[model samples]
Target chain A: MNSHDPVSDCPHIAQFGEAALVLDAPGAMDLGAQQRIWALDAALKEQPGIVETGLGMANLLVSFDPDLWQAEALADWLHDAWVRLPPLAIEGRVWEFPVIYGGERGPDLPFVATHAGVTLEEAARMHAARDYIIFAPSVTPGFGYLYGVDPALVLPRKKVPVMVPEPGTVSIGGVQATIGMTPGPSGWYTLGYTTRFRHPFDPHAEPPLQVAVGDRIRFVIEKVLPC
Target chain B: MDNLALSMGNALLGNPDHAAGIEVQTFPMRLTTTQPHLVAVTGAASAFLDGTPLPPCWVMRLEPGQDLVLKRPTTGARSYITVAGGIDVPLVLGSRASDLRNGLGGHEGRDLRDGDLLPVGPAPHSTGAQDFGAQPPDETLAFTSASDFLDIRVVPGPEHGVFTAAAQAAFWQDDWLVSTMADRMGMRLSGEKLTLAQPTELRSGGILPGVVQVPPSGDPLIQLRDANSAGGYPRLGVVIQADMWRAGQARPGTRIRFHRVTTAQAIAARNEQRDLVAALRRDVARYAELPGFTR
Candidate 1:
């Protein structure tokens, strides 16, 4: 890891607030940038006086106690960490989920198929064919944004969001795919429902999230229920 | 704010055992202690020991079986009760603060219900009644009433330039109303419909409290403490950390206006606020040492 060069992967760091700073990885979302972000998230955790660190799709937010560390020093520390960032070797598990495609389970499946210029069955096959890596948890507890969606199946988000999509609804928006853990408003195009995905947070449970950053996921189509 | 008062109580009582007991929703809850303890009430609420109205931000000693009733604040929305030797709830994620969203922390990861018995940390060897009670300086207390207009300071966000000129102008010029959908997670602000200069799709990224995101609907949402760790919404600006407390105290109908500030200015404001808090802590420590002072 130490043999790796730092200048090529150094991110553009900026101030978020009086006590927090953000390290933004350049370019669109990809595994490389995500790995760099995870590496930096790990590096920041080892620093002294850091209150908390939050990982984003392609960015990392590092918060520190202002009394203990100055803003400039914190920024410098992030730069130093990035320069010495270790090789991306994140340990995670691969979990398989059973999904029901089309019909009432995913009202937007037909819409997504038509938008992507494919038949309903073909859309489901394309979605289930590829393996996805969990980029990071997003929007809700236990909800993860997955990478590796087939570009041919990518679709734009709804102009108006569905106010209460059912929980465990697997959906795609832009180039990313996600699973809804709770019923809430969303703009993603729902393509299926997964029963195997679990709510990632439980207060009494150790390590609240079922999936962490860098985990792998694969969806298997169980059945297509009628709308 | 509760943490600040709890530290003050610990200092005045000469004991490190102190935890903040907060009463949210339907104030004026009564609590009876089994033993004598030093307590202080801060934030947007009033405290009464037995029948005597206790002063806000001042530490008061409670006798055994003495009833303490916390009444709602006339000026603010939340009240904090700091007991010497902090509330003894088993720490979750290394914090005693209740996490309502994840249902962790505090008493069983939930709100303090009626008849709930909270444990307090053991008092240190020097635990004794102080000669003088310490009250926070008036200038140190920042309270906002629902009737008052709020001018919150903000710094431009990463996507601030993507919004149209007119939309940006309206954001700073118009008075936004806090919608009924306000909570610890975030608050929806309704006002001039804000639109972007061009349609853009952003990836989910790290988000912080005070981030003002403008969705396609044009209504701005101010993320709060319990907001999602990351989001894809286009951010217009972020409320300065120093002024976030004001946003937290705002009620549903409160009118809000954004004031743009430079990064340097935001840092300066935060430093100033920290200075005041430090001064208050020092004042409490000094007052507690005065000879022959009593309530």
Candidate 2:
């Protein structure tokens, strides 16, 4: 199924709070699906008095100033935006991320492969071969939820997640891939790492991050270098 | 003036954008303004100026070169102050609000401390006056202890049938107690095992905020604002937006029951609340105390 559509016939429909409406985009993780959701998300920003728009893997929660407009008006505006969201172009360029597999660097590699019924080499090859697209970094500031794990490489998350997974830790779990934003523990496979992210908050220079949702990531194995 | 404490207090007042003032949590907050300023108090707390109890959530004028002090609250968890015009902090992302969890926006992404002087911005548009409800609306319905969530409403998920009808019925009828595991990430509720009819590892799909997802444990996990963007468990339903505040105020021991609602009913309830907000009438001075206005 596409990103916005879920196999679930009755996805929960509810309000996030007093002034926000949450539409569940269950089962929507693919690039094309994310693009559709993103388009609607971007358009929702145009609604007057909207405080901010938070995009998630499966749903878009829109919150506005309750004191300003009637909730019905806001809901109507959103439902219209939903109908108008344009189809996303899937030809987005793919990025190759250099990673250092297994051993000390990737603490979860052996466990991940073992869970996936594969060897370290097979896991690495499978991980690097497929193109995983980033959905959103809202999970933990810079922590990105990259999708498209080779179906064979997927596994359930760890029973307990590490509080601090260390900065730049690359890992995969089940059908999701993650790159640590700051040092924070995780339940995913810790593969390798990179610092190609261009995040700047110099009010004068530009914005905080250069990457957007449609970008793709491809892993390239590289030897670890020291400071 | 305790510039640091004042700004930090303002940042946490109900999502940051609300026209509320800070209740100088800890004191010795001394401010000598060069010009007049406007202010107000919000949330459910009170404030004071110069060691004297100040009217909370109303506008007052600050005189030029005036030294004003904001006293701390004796009760209520958080007290807010509103300047007629909101503080002009740089808006990061799309909000002037601070996200302490991720440490983004507001001042330096940390709590405001001493000597942090603030520049005031133009006041938000005044909604003029209408009707005084005699009292502010109360969200006291928010979950406090564990037993309060007895009537939690949950609907069936697309995979609703994936669970035995009895399991689904049990999910709706049984009383679920708030588990010790609760946070901005999610709240794990303790109830009868919501066993699925069959064990299947669904592909990692999108999970929404407030959606009830059931894992192998049979207990339901209620997602929150800071929840992961996606998950792998079977979801039951989404919580109504109006009830999110209740979830936020949920401390522990909130008993919950699942109730299914039609799309029309959910939409109507949302509209009803909007009508109330629109119908609210309070002066700019009603919420913020603007200091030093001569006209």
Best by lDDT: 1
Q: In model 1, which residue pairs have backbone atoms overlapping below 3 Å?
A: B17-B85, B17-B86, B18-B84, B18-B85, B18-B86, B19-B85, B19-B86, B19-B87, B131-B293
Q: Interface RMSD for every prediction, one decimal? A: 2.0, 5.9
**Each candidate's lDDT (Cα)?**
0.75, 0.57
Chain A of candidate 2 gets a TM-score of 0.80
DockQ for every prediction shown: 0.53, 0.22
Worst 10 residues of 1 chain B by lDDT: B137-146
**lDDT (Cα, tens digit) per residue for candidate 2, span B1-295:** 1121233233222113343233343443555556655544443345445545554343345567555565444432234444545666777776555566667666665556777766567744443321111223343222222333434433345466688788888877887788889766678988788887787665444455667888777888888655676566776667655445345444347677666765455555555544434333322234323434322
Local accuracy of candidate 1 as per-residue lDDT tens digits, B54-138? 7666677777778888777676555666676677888776677777766778888887788988888866443243434555523
Candidate 2 segments exceeding 4 Å error: A1-87, A114-119, A135-138, A141-143, A195-207, A224-227, B1-37, B46-76, B123-134, B139-239, B246-272, B282-295
Q: Considering only chain A, what is the TM-score of each predicted structure? A: 0.88, 0.80
